[model samples]
Target: MPRAWTLRSRPNGMPTADNFELRDAPVPRLEDGQVHVRNRWLSVDPYMRGRMNDVKSYVPPFQVGEPLEGGAVGEVVDSRAEGFAAGDLVLHMAGWRDEAVLPATALNKLPQLGVEPQAFLGNLGLTGGTAYFGLLDAAQARQGDIVFVSAAAGAVGSAVVQIAKAKGMTVIGSAGGPAKCDFVRSLGADAVIDYKAGPLVKSLAEAAPKGIDVYFDNVGGDHLDAALAHARKDARFAICGMIEGYNAAEPMCFRYIMRVIAMRIMLKGFIYTDYLPRMGEFFADMGALVASGQVKSRDTVVGGLENTPDAFLGLFTGANTGKMLVKL
Candidate 1:
């Protein structure tokens, strides 16, 4: 029997360990067009927090008592589908479990990217894709632009820093501590703001001086407010994630909403799936950047399946510098 984490109850505010129940379950027999996968790597992201709640959003809510799901990389152990074989590596959304039985249509064969399979769960997967499409397509970041990225030491934000630098942009990243700020600077950010040091708006104003042309928002609330306050005319903003308010009991209020109109800022909320039709373009460009060493993958992996819940909770606590994963 394999073990999986089942949601025992919907979270009220921040999730607790008691919300999840680990249960041993039997692996289903592979039927025609089905494959059995032994998961190797599981992704823990902030967006998953939204799904845990019973709400109508871009994706459906996670049903209580069912296994919670997210991105995962695994190796096929049994296959009844054509073109898929035993021992083939694959990426799927049947995560939060040690083993999964999924339709072959739901699995993507792993690419030989000269990186570990888990990279598919991080820099080379949705994490990187979000940064790629959000910055280049949604935010429209360009050469000579001053770009501000919030939560710059996290998975998608770090990628944004590298991609912006690769495209000849001046990048400013905001992180919580000196070490994370240093990590952001090492990723080619022209300036790194320690958000914990003082007021974000003041720090960002000082770092940009001339105001930012583009803002890649990961942490909302104060970060968004700061970006709005220091935005250049015709600035573009890509609203990717708002981890700041994810666990909040009350709605987050903003004092700089009027700045968007006054500054003529263009703010857009986007999901990577919105640009799925153009994924080939993303693969070609991001793959080249990664292979050429202009873009790099960074990760913080927690070992074992039992730690997956803790790994997920850590996303809110700044426990990871890059992509956070559980090596199952």
Candidate 2:
């Protein structure tokens, strides 16, 4: 039997432990194409705040009384599939469950790449991949270009800062506090903006005396508007997750609609799943960076499956410094 966190109630604004109920159940049997896995680590991200709402999203909403699932790293305990074998380390989307039965297609074999396995859920997984494709493909950053990123101390933002620096771009980052600001600077960001200091527009203006050529937006709301104001002509804005407005009763409207057209910024909103096709290329490049020490990966890990709810809810309050995960 495995214990899992199931949805107890839909969250109103911010989710608490009350919204989740932990229950135990027998390990499921593997179907024809499925593999049984015992999860080692589970990830909790801010974008999941939107999934709590009973609204339509790129991914389906979490149903009441069902287990809440997300990215997880685990080991194959039983396999009914060809490519996988028992004891093989794998990464897949299995959520908060201590054990899961998933189709082989949803699982990827983890390389013995010397880095921490949690990096698969952060740096080399969806977070890092999102930053890689979003900045390079969507934002089209060029050498010497100036770039600004919101949620700059976070998993994905940290990856963006390093990738931009590696590409010879001047990167500026906006984070909530001085600690995170310094963290981004440590990741090679040319400038760091403390968004909690004052009006983001003013802070960004001071940080970026020259207009920014690319804006990788993760925390939307006023941050998006501020980036729009300081953008250069024909700048590219890769609109990723909007953690800021995820808990609000209503989604925040972008006040810089006119600026998008006026500045000729090519703004594109994307879900990380859209980049699944390029995961191979992402894994190859990002894996090389990790192996070579160009990119740094960090995880704030909580021990025990019982603490999964706290880890999930902590994302809303920016409690964790980097990627938030629970070790089962």
Candidate 3:
């Protein structure tokens, strides 16, 4: 038997440590075409917060009384599938449980990249992949461009900065604290702005007087508006995550949306799963970047399976600098 966290209630505002409960259960068994995986690492991300409430969104909300679900890395402990065997590491949409029985289709065999295995949950996985595609394929950044990113110390945000920098762009990032700003600078950002200290619009103007060519938005609300005001002609905006307004009761104001019409800005919101077909190419490019030391992957490990909920809640409060993962 192993313990797992289950949703106790849909959160009304910011989640408390009590919105979830930890309980024990028997390890699941594999049926035909199914493989039983012993989870080793679990991801805790800001996107999961949107799925906690029973609201219409990009993905379905987490059902009440069900074990919370998200991305995880695990090893096959038993298999009823033909191609998989015990000890093979894989990635799946398995949630907060210690173990799971999933159809082989949901599992992707992880490559032995010789980096930390957890990088499969961070840089080598969807986080890095999202930054790669969203910026290159979607935003289409070019040489000598000015790029700005929000939530810039996070796993995905950090990757966006490095990718833009490597492509010869001047990258400016906005984070919450001086520590996170320093981390962003260390990642090769040309300028770092601490949004918590003063007005974001003024800071962006001072840092990027020529104006921004790409806006990789992770924190929305005021951050989004400020970036739009400073966007250069034909700028591209990738609306990734909106941590600033995740817990808000009403939608954040977008008074500057008129600028999109006037400026002809290409504004788009994306969910990484929608670009599944391009994942092969995306992963290959990011792999080479990591191999050549052009991009770096990082994780903040939260120990103990029982503490998973706290780790997930930390995403909203900026408690993590990179990917937040739980080690069992």
Candidate 4:
């Protein structure tokens, strides 16, 4: 018998460990056109938090008693599908479990980028794609522009910093503490603000004396306000995630909401899947940057399938940095 996590109950505000239930899940018999997969790495992301609640959104909400699904990398143990074979490495959306029986159509073979298997869960997968499309497409960041990225030490944010620097942009990254700020500095940001040290707007102002031309927002709330306050006219803003208000009891009220009109800002919300049609372009460019050592990646790994709930909770508590994964 294998184990999988299920949504035990929807949370009122912040989710707790008790909200998830771990139970014995028997591996189902593989039907025709199906494969049996043993998950090697499981991804935990901020977006998954929203799925826990039973609400209508971009993606459907997770059912209260069903096995939770997410991105994962696994090796095919057995396959009834024609193209897939035993021992093939594949990426799928059958996570939150130790093992899975899935249709062949649901699996994607890992790219031959010459990187580690879990890199797909981070640098080359959702996180990386989110950063690339959000900054370059949604924000319309260009060379010589000053870019401000919130959650600079995070998976998507770190990628944005390196990508911006590689393209000859001035980057001002905001992270929580000294260690995170130092990590952003290593990513070649022109300025790294320790957001926890003082007022976010004040730090951002001091970092980029000139108003920023691009804002890559991850932790919205106050970070959104700060970017709005300091945006140069016609600045483009990519609203990727608002993690700050995700678990908060009250809704976020931007103090400088009026700046959007006054500064003529262009704020757009987008998801990485919006660029799936351009997948080949992303793979060619991002893969090269990664191989050239210009773009680096990191992960905070929690070992075991049983600890998946804790690993997911860690995202809100800042318990992990870079991409957070559960090594099963």
Candidate 5:
């Protein structure tokens, strides 16, 4: 018998382990054009927190008593699909389960990137895709631009820092602690702000006295307000995630939102799926960066399927440096 995590209940505020239940599930027989996979790695991301709520968003909300889903990399155990075979590694969204029986169309064959298969779930997958598209396409970051990134030690933020640096942009990153600030600095940030130390807006103002040309927002609320205040005229803002307010009981009010008009800031929210058509471009660019050691892959891996809920909960606690994963 295989085990999978189910959404026991909708979280009131911050999610707890009690909201998830691990139950034994039967692996369905492989039908035509279907394959059975034994997941090797499961991804736990901040965006999944939004999915837990019963809301109308880009993706549907997770249903109660049903298995939660996210990215997973696994080896094929049995296949009735034409293009796939036993022992082929694949990536899919049937995670939170030890084994998955899904259609071939749902699985993407992992490319031989000279890296571990788990890399597909981090630097070479959605994590990388989000950062790449968000920074380049959405934010339109250019060489010599001053870019400010929030949650700079997290998966997407770290990538944003590195990508901006690689493109010759001056980057300032904001993280929660000394260690995370150090990590962000190591990723080539011109300056790193310890948001936990003092007021975020004050720290950002001090770091960029001339105002920022672009803002890559991962943590919303105060971070967003800080970016709005310090934005240069006609600055571009790529709105990625708002992990700070994800579990909040009430909406966060922005005091500097009025500056959006005065500064002529372009704030845009985006989903990675919208850039799926350019996935080949992402792979070619990011793969080369990773291979050349320009863009590094960092992850915090929790062992076992049972701890998946803990890994997911850890996102809000800054328990992960980069991408968080569960080794199944």
Candidate 6:
């Protein structure tokens, strides 16, 4: 029998294993216009945390006792649809399980990018897509710009660091500790701040004394404040993820709210799916970057579907340096 993980209950603060259930989920028979797949990889992302709450969001909340879903790469074992056959590789949203019978409309043949199957879950999928559109479109980062990135050693942030470097931007990245800071530096950041060591406001000022032309925010709170305080006139900011306050009980307060007015900064909040119509452009550009080796992936993989809950909890704890995945 195959298996699937379900949301047993909602969490009050940070989620625990008690909130998830791994159960026997035998694969079902394929209906017309559907394909049966054996999932090979499952993605765990920060955004999935918000979905766990039974609140209204851009996407529907995961129902209790139902299988949780995320990015997944799988192989087709059977198909009742055109353009799909056995042994075909596909990407779909039927994750948190080992096998699924899904509609053909919800499936896509993995682009012939020549990257590994798992890369689609990391650099080639949401992680890379988020960074690509967030930086270039939302932040309007240009060559010769000085940029600052929060959670610089993270999955999306790591890609942002490399992409900015490849495009000739002077980059500064902030990571929690020395090891992560070193990791960000190796991604070609001009300056790496060990945010755990000292004040970020001071760190940003020292790193880019000329002031930053762009800010890519992954962790909000102090990072947002620091970017606001350090932003030059007409600076552009892309609000990506605010992982710092995801599990917080109270609202976040920014200390440098006045900076936005003083410096005339433009803040743009975006979701990668906003560019779905523009995926051709994203693939054309990002695929070349991947081919050039300018953009690569660093992933922390947890093996087994039973460990999916642990892998998801790891996102809030900074347990992953890059992409966090469960190898199904």
Off-target runs (Cα >4 Å) in candidate 4 are none
Candidate 3 or 6, higher lDDT?
A: 6
Q: What is candidate 6's lDDT per residue for 1-328, written digit by digit as tens? A: 8888899999888888999998889877888899999999999899998899999988999999999999999999999999999999999998999999999999989989889999888888889999999999999999999999999888999999999999999999999988999899889999998888889899888998999999999999999999998899999999998998888899889998788998999999999889989988988999999999999888999999888989989888779998898997
**After superposition, which runs of candidate 6 have C-alpha atoms over 4 Å from their true positions?**
none
Weakest 10 consecutive residues, lDDT, candidate 4? 313-322
- Count clashes in each candidate, considering only residues at least 3 apart in sequence or on different chains: 0, 2, 0, 0, 0, 0
lDDT tens digits, residue span 1-328, model 2: 6888899999988888899999986776678998999999899888777788899878899999988889999999999999999999999888789898889999999977787788889988888888999999888888999999999888889899999998899999988898888888889998999888899889989999998999999988998999888999999999888888877878787666688888898998877888888877887888888888889977788999999899888887777877888988
Candidate 3 per-residue C-alpha lDDT over 1-328 given as tens digits, one digit per residue, 9 for 90 to 100: 8777888998888999879988885765558999999999998888899899888988899888888888899999999998899999999988698998889999998986777778888888889888888888678888988999998899899999999988899999999999999999999999999999999889999999998999998989999999888988899999888888889989899767788877889988888887889877877778888888999866788998988998888888888998889998
lDDT accuracy of residue 27 in candidate 3: 67
Residue range 1-328, candidate 1, lDDT tens digits = 8999999998888999999999997887779999999999999899999999988999999999999999999999989999899999999998999998999999999877677788787777899999999999899999999999999999999999999999999999999999999999889999999999999889988899999999999999999999998998999999999999999978888888898888999999999789879867877888889889999978898999999999999999999999999998
Find the 10 residues in a row with the least total lDDT in model 3. Answer: 22-31
Write the number of the candidate with greater TM-score, choosing between 2 and 6: 6
User: How well does each candidate superpose onto the true structure, as a TM-score?
Assistant: 0.98, 0.96, 0.97, 0.99, 0.99, 0.98
In model 2, residue pairs whose N, Cα or C atoms come closer than 3 Å (at least 3 residues apart or on different chains), thus clashing, are 69-95, 70-95
Per-residue alpha-carbon lDDT of candidate 5 for residues 1-328, written as tens digits (9 for 90 to 100): 8999999998999999889999998987779999999999999998888888899999999999999999999999999999999999999999999998999999999987798899888888999899999999999999999999999899889999999999999999999889999999888899999998999889998999999999998989999999998999999999999988988888999999999999889999999899989988988999999999999978899999999999988899989998899998
lDDT computed for candidate 4: 0.93
RMSD of each: 0.9, 1.4, 1.2, 0.8, 0.8, 0.9
Question: Which prediction has more favorable TM-score, 1 or 3?
Answer: 1
- Give the TM-score comparing model 6 with the true structure, all chains together: 0.98
Per-residue error for 251 in candidate 4, Å, reads 0.9
Q: Distance (Å) between predicted and true CA of 245, model 1?
A: 0.5
What root-mean-square deviation over C-alphas does model 1 reach? 0.9
